[model samples]
Target chain A: MAEIAATASKRDVGRGRGLVAAIAWRSLWRNRRRTWLTAGGIAFGVSLVVFSMAFQAGSYGDMIYNATSFLTGQVQIQRADYIELSRFEQTIGDATETLRRVEQQAGVLSATARVEAFALVSVDERSFGAQVLGVDVERERQVVNFFDRLSRGRVMAGPDETVIGSGLARNLNADLGDEIVVLGSAKRGGVAAMVLDIVGIFDSGISELDRSLLFVPIAAVQNEFGLGDEVHTIVVRTQVDDSRAVVEALGHQLPEGLSVRNWDEVLPEIRQGIDVDRLGGMFMYAIVLMIITFSIVNTFTMTVFERLREFSMLKAVGMRPGKIVLMVQIEALLLWAIGVGIAMGLMVPLLAWLQSSGIYLGEAIVELAKQYYITDRIYPALGPASLLAAPAVMLAATQIAAFASSLRIYWLRAAAGVRAAE
Target chain B: MSSDIVVSCKGVSRTYQEESVPVHALRGVDFEFARGEFVSIAGPSGSGKSTLLNVIGGLDRPDAGTITVDGVELNGLNETELSDLRLHKMGFVFQSYNLIPVLSALENVEFIMQLQGVGPAERAERAMSMLDSLDIVDLADRRPGDMSGGQQQRVAIARSIVTNPVLLLADEPSANLDSATTEDLLQLLRRLNEERGVSILTATHDPIVMSYAQRQVNLRDGAIVEDSAAKVA
Candidate 1:
């Protein structure tokens, strides 16, 4: 019996709430043109917000993926001075052992060691300074995309064998099965010199990488450099999109001379580029939305004044001042919902079309990509945050405007309000 | 009918600040209305008839006197408490803008009941019954804009009485009505007062409204000049 009575009482309260909400919602449609104009402002603001956010997010992903795939891995275990100096003396003494330990880390998918040195290569009276990367033939593929990125012969077959980049081969006038002289100042005692056979050549489409890269077996690099057991860097690939977890996990457990550097640390310039772009996007969003807020305030203030008599009638009819505020906020939310819905409707198709046909960055970007190792085509990605944040900000800003304008209504005296001119 | 007082005022005075002058709308007035009695405050424009009714209805507070409704001091209650009193106990009929423009005739009636937390089924039933009694059941779904002046007044009456309020205050309700409509509205108020035992107060300059009151109070320049009991029609 008590439960039944309680349910009935709750039902009555709910009925009252439903009626209040219905009245508020109906009030929005009373001035259709004003409502549409306000909704249009929100749509314009949020469309820009959504488009910029999605573009920035997608561009960041592409840059990170390309940067990591082409050159850097997710994390790098390197000597403390190797990044800055690149000196042969600053080598990881037990790089193979470090690679084994990193591979066993929780999120680590694969790991490879490399001994890189700036060496002079000569073939048939032509010579060029090339960066020789001594790598494990099988393990290097798991870290970088170089193995599958081949155009000519395969990866280095054995010791004293090398795979030269097409640009470097062209510069040195070298061909497949040609023997090239490579000389480097070894860290131990002597000048390291070798006549290595070029068994393969490759083109990665990145002109910088193709211009000055040569790959040889790590064992050969160790023997030639007179450093039998040391490699300069150990690169690890994590199984996840973010490497922070793996980097933090292994940072504390590494040997005395080694530190774990994630992609951001290894490539701070790329991280800064993404950060600057994100900040620019947010700055644009804030400016547009602040104008939208003022528009809301102006729109609602005019509405509140025009409807003073109506509000006064409602007050006389026993509508609370707080409910009046809620009614205005409901109007704001309704406008936001309509605007965001339209923007999303328009954005989805546009983004899909752009995604299908990747955005061409034009001549400047294409030249920059050729000059550096950057990719030309950017595929913008839309994340869940962009999908959620735009509407959230629009509604919040509009509600604040609505609340600020509705404050004027609470000061409306019922007696004067009833007599106030329409 | 019982003669217990529903509204009482003592030495009620109000001043209005208009530009640079203070206009005394009401001055040291004492008044009382008994339960179920229909009284009309009649005067010319700016004679404080509206101000007196506004004070009695808790829509405006007296600056220098006390107004009491149903044992609750009007000056002592906060805005929210006063709103609750009006929602549950008092009804109003304005001279114009009586109905919310967006609401239908039926919905306007249900709005009061809904605000009072009446069950949906009960609110709809009582609203329909009120519309039926007012002879406007066919216009239940018609919005206020679609209704004629007379028809809208009838709908306003339905809304006012649907809650069964203890006091029904009408301020110049017949101001915009034609003579025939004024006569009809006055008769309807008389019927509601007699049938439902509702205490009625009306502030108006309309002679038609003044004629139907059980008692009439006359005001001039913010002071009551005469009080007399008149025969009910």
Candidate 2:
């Protein structure tokens, strides 16, 4: 029969999705080079964003870990006034008991108590002022990462043995096995003096640290300073990256005069640095996505403009303008999917490799990075946020471009369009 | 508003703005076509033949006057309503065949039914049956670019009439076809009109297309100068 009748079945059965999508998909390949170029632009932009996001995440995590591990640990419990004043008289009185309590808290990986005092170190005729930290040897090894910078000799195993910074050793003209005399004011107005054997020398790479920091046994400091078991701070190593939670949990259990501080509070410089760098990265990414969006807008505008007659013909045969617009949007969706798919195909394996094996910064760059406590190697992170953020933004951008370009269909008069083709 | 009249246009006037000058495409035209009748509007370029078809098909609105298609007034209908009315009641065949280039012949035929939410199995069946009737069933999977102009026009006709519209409007349908292909297309239209009881209104200046019509109305400068039906009656 020449005539075909309309069926009275369900009005919303299929909505011609397959046919419309097929048309939209096939229409992209009509100009193969333009399609490739547009898709390539999307791929390049998305890949750059995704890769950089991963790298930023990985490097920032490494920086935070290193910064905390060096001396601050992930969380710290200190006498309330000690963090600001750093005086020998203001100290945590029952520090050993407080350390034990903090180590019992969930997410507290390890804890060590230390006594910090400013003293004069004299080896024969040479004498210089230095900041000496008296720590529990085994526990300090577990909590602090400064031992990783040890250049000579072993960590102190005797009460009177100490490790001095290389710069301090140079100033005092002291060598390993030399006995150095430490003298400082006592907590109660008497003389605090000690003679310690220098067992190790470390170069921490920071000029300030190398010039004046030293570590001795906590017993020796408590005996000489007349403070029997008092400590200035208890450094905590948290089990996970969420140190604030650990710090909060530890805060409620600590003694009345002690306070717990997370890495962000103890090291605000790192947080501020990350925030500023992230802002800059976001601005750069926005510019990249905006340029890509402009290219997409141009692409769809030309696609729709060139097929004016086809769209008008569609309208003439009873297709709504909304449906025509939807078709164009579907084309945009297909294009984005192609670009994202290609990116994922190439990026997943590469990011996996980078995550497994980090890229090493050379010796010169490592020395420069060490001042900020960053490690020698950097890894690209492979996480859901890094994977999804860029593609999601691109998807939204492309859809907006498609919708903007397709608005011209609303102004299309089917009669004029068809007549113009004639 | 007669039940037998498929379309009615009264005192229709249309004007176009060409740059800074005004051109009257149609001036105070009155015309009507009965159900199941084959009629042709014959005129030269700029004589308003396509303009009359466009206005009657509800693709364009008249600047003055009223048009009623299949008993519904086109005067106040919104774009969406006009689209719905056209989808269910009217079909159009353009001079250039204007088939969606991405779609195959059968897909083009089934597309209208698809838009109407017809079942896939049934629309495909009907599309294939329609193509077979047009004697081009073998070209069903071929795209328009691969088919001859005659074959493409046949597919276009299949697409337009597949939804069983009450009125089929053809604008210069034979303008791109050779003499032999034009004759074949006219015969196909004649068969579809007689067998399916569809009302057809074609706007053309071709003598062959006019000769196949039951009634011919000639236009000059946007006004109807002669009506064969009025003379016959």
Candidate 3:
């Protein structure tokens, strides 16, 4: 009995491997064009998914960075009442103490205080409404790199000097060393106005900021507006490794009249924009996947119909219906693997090149993006998750499509079919 | 010697449904083939010869009656068991030569051994030996499409015999071949039966095929009309 069992097992192993090899090789080589076409369909679908996902991811990353570093810091700490109402009556008095405490917290990389107000700036006859920012130049530069992005002149050099955005400069017909007048209502119901020389013009690649941002020394803006010893907000930069933890900690420790917001929440609209972009990407991917599914199904069905006589011959030779089903499945899987593999091989380098070179949306799309999403540039960034996820999704989709097309072969009765054909 | 019955069929019937009508392809066919016998099932087109072949080969199930091959009842076995019976004990050569176009002659011959669970080394050895026996060893690596009709038919025969099956069923094996190739194939079949003691049951309408057989079972419509043995004495 033991000898019989051993012999049976040996035969099984030998036959199993041989059968698998013969079936896989023959099935792959038999209908070369059909197999390749199915594979190409899967690869095309996967490549579209991978490239689009990578591009969308990169663009989102760029959008957030261009919006935040170019304007808002990673985290913003402000008076609770100031956030809710922005009333001139409520402000953070002695923000230096809070700034010192925030800087000491773990992951808190840098901290600076700023006061912001709506005002109008005029250069010669041209005037535009602007958000005037009162900043500690050294700390602001550390957080935002505003000095390096200056397109024309230097950043604020002293208390009376200011830096206007490039778009604002273009609109106002102003340049470095030009005098601009700032006009607005002060905190105490008194009209406030000041004359400052533009020290530089900076472009943050964000159209909104470029058109309406004016940076001045924090002390000068405070004195000119008659807001004594009060800072409107404290901008903090947290270490990348501990940004979320630091934000949560700061949210707890901040005083009642103050509120803290991470970069994500500070720009809810940007997050919403990203979500919309992701949905658009999903819609496009679904369309492409559907097209690929149809192509694969069509090819497989045609192959099956064309090879009916061959299948009949296999059945006549005593191959089980189940083995026939398995053979068809293996063929489908091979085609899918080949197609997706080729597509991925082609797309990886293509997407990497795109990541480095970026897809130029042309001037019209750039302007449209600026007007719609408040940014001028679109950069593709693929995260690790997006890169890995796109391929998995595509493979799963192809498998389902292939399986659906294999049903006819699986249920085929060799005996009946062959007799009928004969 | 009577104990060596390769196939025994009793009251076997097959009905194929077409559109909404039933076409009886075989009716109460009682047949038997002995071990080492080269038998031919002769019938005109639309007769029951192919149907009888299919039923005996376990490629089709009879609507009624029983078929026993090597004393194993084919009707009682399930689909898998029947498939195993075909894979292990019986080999089939088709009228069309039905060799897989993608596979080379050697691979086509190796396929039955593959189905029978033969290892790569053994399958290669047996397939090459079979092709050599049929005098087509040089064409072993050529695909069916790359070979002539006679060569393809010879490869098909080699594939049928590669697994060392007890019964080799050939359905019009020489239908597509020229007269010379047909004579060559008949000689090969005669040699296999005479030397190897392999039981063969072939279905054909050709008188040439009938002349080579030791026994002929003639079918008309759906029933056997005559069963006659050639006088070898």
Candidate 4:
């Protein structure tokens, strides 16, 4: 023993890792029912968290796509002050050149130039203030598809033709083919006027746009308004999920006065709506995870307290307190791994099924869904963010609870502990 | 300070607080236990025999004075150093047998040697040899929960002496055993003492245990009252 002791003093003590790990592994099964129940609870919580995150991501994606597809076009480029001031004088000078430059950027599916001016429309007895959007008819087709929702006639086919919203058409008590005169102030403070034949009336499902917006060919508006080869904004449709990427890609390349805006910036209420809904969902997930964490803490506390005598015996037999604490931590990690593994096994396929076979909300919400540019079918999207969030939280929380509960061993006196057991 | 003395304690005093009132478990115990000697500390309940055993084994510290085990002072050593000293040089046999429940008998016996960084093959051979000496090699793979009290105590004894410590401390080793089993246990300790010359110090109230010892020290209250060896001299 003295010879062995002398040799041991040279080598590292507490190095018998295999038996310690084995001891830890076997100890977890001492209460098989409790272990399984706790692991099952973790699995249930993780599955719920991952599944709900997938659904949220899927729904948010759909909402953003729907809202941006028709009006915002995912990304837009305009004069630095144009979005805030909406000044007719603040316009991009080379509309065709700007459109060409924006279309050339990567991830840009399509780009269209438009001129916007606030005007008064009059047809005989009725007159109301409206926002007239001057758009390049052919290129606009590739950017926005509101024209597909036209209720009467067709999209503007000539320089003097226009498409008015359904609400505006109803307000003016006007029909397709009726001519209306638009009057506005152009750049240089001159009177800009035009008589456009109402060729189409569209119900965009958005009341704000339907009540106050109109569209006409860019050339006629430019010709009458005396705005030579200039447009207010260039809208770009992107294939990417986030419009900010395209905006960043186009940031340095654009002319100095031009500023790029993502769909969120263009339509802040949609972003705000998604953010508020996401916060509420996160709060719910946090509550679920916190509950699971508390249960884990309780489980570990009971385990350590009940095993104090056994731990004291180990210590008396020459086991370091750190080794014993390490064993408990290993048990926690194993539990976490088992729970998360089962959760992944169950959730991956479940999410795949939900992703492919979307949940249909039925016709009751079709109209209401349409108002927010959402559809009846919502597909749950499984991405990296949703895949990893729950398991990471469980792992971190489990280790913390285990370490906290296992700390009592460090303060336990070996002889007192053994005697207390007696 | 002589090399022949396995344990030395001088003016050792330990006090415990039970509900804020001080209980003097040990008051100024001074003694030297020689190598290869089988000694028993005999006392009634709360007579401080167990406390003296604990202090000498380094399982508990003396609040005043000093304890030196095999020339290493217990007063100056840190917790880890004390643990190492216990692991390498001292062995403990409890009345309850205190074998780790999760470990098989063989693993429990090999546990201390493993902590000493012995190779796996040597640890297994030595553990089996020790169990064989105790006539319990057949119970090697059996867990403590699957064994009777006598069999468990034999395994605990095998674990304690497997690493061949300088001193073995038994605190009421026969307290939970029947008469027949106690005879077998005492014979085994005597045989180990005769054959291998291992020093042992046991604290117990049992007359049978005290009868098996070569020398007996009797205590009352918190101090030693009689020494059989001194009386014999």
Please, what is the whole-model Cα lDDT of each candidate in the order they appear?
Answer: 0.83, 0.89, 0.79, 0.88
Colliding pairs, model 2: none
Q: Compared with the true structure, what per-residue lDDT tens digits does model 2 show for residues A234-303? A: 8999853769899778778776778889898899999999899889999999999889989999999999
Where does candidate 2 stray beyond 4 Å?
A1-14, A255-257
Best by TM-score: 2
Write down the DockQ of candidate 3: 0.33
TM-score, candidate 2, is 0.94
lDDT of 1 by residue, A8-112 (tens): 345434446666677767888889998888888888888888887877777777777677866678889888877777778888886667778888888888889
Error of 3 at B40 (Å): 2.6
lDDT: the better of candidates 1 and 3: 1
Superior by lDDT: candidate 3 or candidate 4: 4
Model 1 residue A55 lDDT?
77
Candidate numbers, best TM-score first, in rank order: 2, 4, 1, 3
- Model 2's chain A TM-score stands at 0.92
Q: After superposing candidate 1 on the true structure, give the runs of residues whose Cα lies further than 4 Å from its correct spot.
A: A1-15, A81-90, A118-131, A146-155, A163-187, A197-214, A252-257, A349-365, A369-376, B1-3, B229-233
Q: What tens-digit string does per-residue lDDT give for candidate 3 at A83-111? A: 88987657788777888888988888888
After superposing candidate 4 on the true structure, give the runs of residues whose Cα lies further than 4 Å from its correct spot: A1-14
- Candidate 2 vs candidate 3: which has greater DockQ? 2
Model 4 lDDT tens row, A1-422 = 34434565675355677677778788889999878888887898899999999999999999999888887799989999887897888889978887888888888999988888899998889999999998887887798876778988898889888999999998999889899989999778889988989999999877788889999898888888878999998989986475678899899899887889999888899999999999999999999999999989998998999899888887787776777899899999988888899999999998899898999989898888888778899999999999999999999999999999999998888888888877
lDDT of 4: 0.88
TM-score of chain A of 4: 0.94
